[model samples]
Target: MKATTARGTIEAGDVGEGRPVVLLHALALSGRLFDPIAAEWAPRRRVITPDARGHGGSDWDGRPFTGEDMADDVAALIETLVGGPADVIGMSMGGSTAVLLAQRRPDLVARLVLADATADYGPDRVQTWAERAEKAVNVPREKQVDFQIDRWFSPSFVEANADEVRRVCDIFVVTDSAAHAAACHALGTVAAVGELGTISAPTLVMVGDEDYATPPAMAEQLAAGIPDSRLEVLTATRHLSLIQRPDVWPEIEKHLDA
Candidate 1:
């Protein structure tokens, strides 16, 4: 289904019949990234997955946007669809957005799950992101697939799950360079650590032991900063812990049910 928000039209998948749970995707990916999670949760909970503004079926005007803007988009989504606070699970970039959502619109979030995400990228992130944005705009997406794959998955995972890896790669290659650059810039500008204490909802900060993109230290920071939060590090996983380690769902399920 589609909902008109303050930012733009947001395309989402709403299924099941119970308390709502919103699943947000990582950068260069869409709500479709949560298909497995949606399918699993739909039997017991309402699963709502919306494509972040610039990726997948969602609309983006090629203008620059911040993580807070993305969070507001989610805020509008919950108000229009769920009609109340819902459990929110965000991965990577989406994780950062979830933190902003909890900080800026606490009423819209009940339980929070941040997977492979960080509150801040540090002082050098600006130049780092600028360089990455330049690459996204200048380099062909196909050329960058290997680098992304290596960063997203562990060596064992890539060796064992070729088809799944390919599926994610296809999504990455099709993403518009401009949109990817915009998201990179937005991620670089994130600085939400100081606001973590403001989040009142129970929170779970999960990360991969092998995740270099948003490492375990970052998860520790999230857990330490948030008033009611804990950290869990999945063993032998990379940036995409949910995909790389499906067993982690029980932990997520435990948290949600708590």
Candidate 2:
């Protein structure tokens, strides 16, 4: 369904009907990236997965946007469509947005699950993101796939899961460079760790030990900053651990149940 919120028209998947849970995808990925999560959760809870503006079926304003801006969009979504506060799960760039949502619009969030995400990407990291933004804007899509695959998965995982790698690579190749570049630039602006104390929602921060993009150290920092949050490190997985490792779901389910 399409939701006309403060951010504009958002294309979303609203499935099941119970306690609400929203899943946010990483940069360059649309709501489709959460197909597995949605399928699993839809059997019990109301699962909402929206294509963050500029990706998939959503409309982009054709300008640069920030994590806070996207968070506002989600705020409007839950308020106007979901009818109350909702649990939110975010990964990568989406996780940054979730943090912003909990900070800036606390009333809209019930709980937060930040997977393979960070609250701060320092100056050096910002420079790296800027370089990535440049590449996303200028490099050919075909060439970008390898770069993404290297950052998203470990070498062993890639060799063992060729089909999954290809599936994600297909997502990378078709992503809109301008949108991806804008998000990359937005990532440089994240600095939420300092204000994490203001968040009151129950928060769970998880990361893959092998995730180079947002390593376990980043998850540790996020957990330390958030008032009483917990951190879990999933071993033998890379950036996209949720999909790569199914065993983590039981732990995630326990968090949500709590």
Candidate 3:
């Protein structure tokens, strides 16, 4: 389904029937990232998977946007679709956006889950992100697959799941370069740590012990900052642990069902 928001037209997958559970995707990925999860949870919940602006089927006007801006876009979508508070689960870049959403529009989020995400990227983030953005647009997307995959999954998992890794790589290569750059810039600018204490919803912060992109240390920051939150670390997992290890779903389900 598609909804018009002040930012742009936001497209999403709205499936199942019951309380809504919004699954936000990672950078350079789309709502399709949560297809399997959505299907599994559909029997008991309404799953909403939206493509952040500039990714997937969503719209982007070439202008730069912030995590806060993306959160507001989500806020508008929730108002149009869910009509009230819903459980929000975000991963990677999506997790960062979720943090902003909970802080800016706490009323729209009943429960929260931040997977392999962070509130800040530290002092050198600006330059670091700018360099990544430059590389994203200048370097051919296909060439970056190995670099991205290595960071997203552990070596053992990558060797064991060739087909699944290929699928995610396909998505990564096809994503718009400009959009990817913009998202990189947005992530680099993230400094939501100070605001984490303001989130009122029950929250769960999860990360893979092997995750290097956001790292478990970042997850600890999120868990510690949020007043009502807990942290769970997945052993032998990497950045995209949710996909790399679907068994982690039960842990997320437990938090949401609570």
Q: Against the hidden true structure, what lDDT does model 2 obtain?
A: 0.86
Q: Compute each candidate's TM-score over C-alphas.
A: 0.98, 0.95, 0.98
lDDT of 2 by residue, 87-114 (tens): 9999888899899999998888888899
The reply for model 2, stretches above 4 Å from the true place, is none
**Candidate 3 residue spans exceeding 4 A from truth:** none
lDDT of 3 by residue, 39-68 (tens): 899998999999999999899889988988
Which one wins by TM-score: 1 or 2? 1
Residue lDDT tens for model 1, 1-258: 888876679999888989899999998888888888888888988999999888888888878988888999999999888778999999999999999999999998999999999999988988998899999989999999999998999999999999889988988999888899999999998999998999999999999999999999999999999999988888999999998888888789889988
Error of 2 at 106 (Å): 1.1
| Candidate 1 stretches greater than 4 Å from native | none
Better of 1 and 2 by lDDT: 1
Q: List the residue pairs that clash in candidate 1.
A: none
Full ranking by lDDT: 3, 1, 2
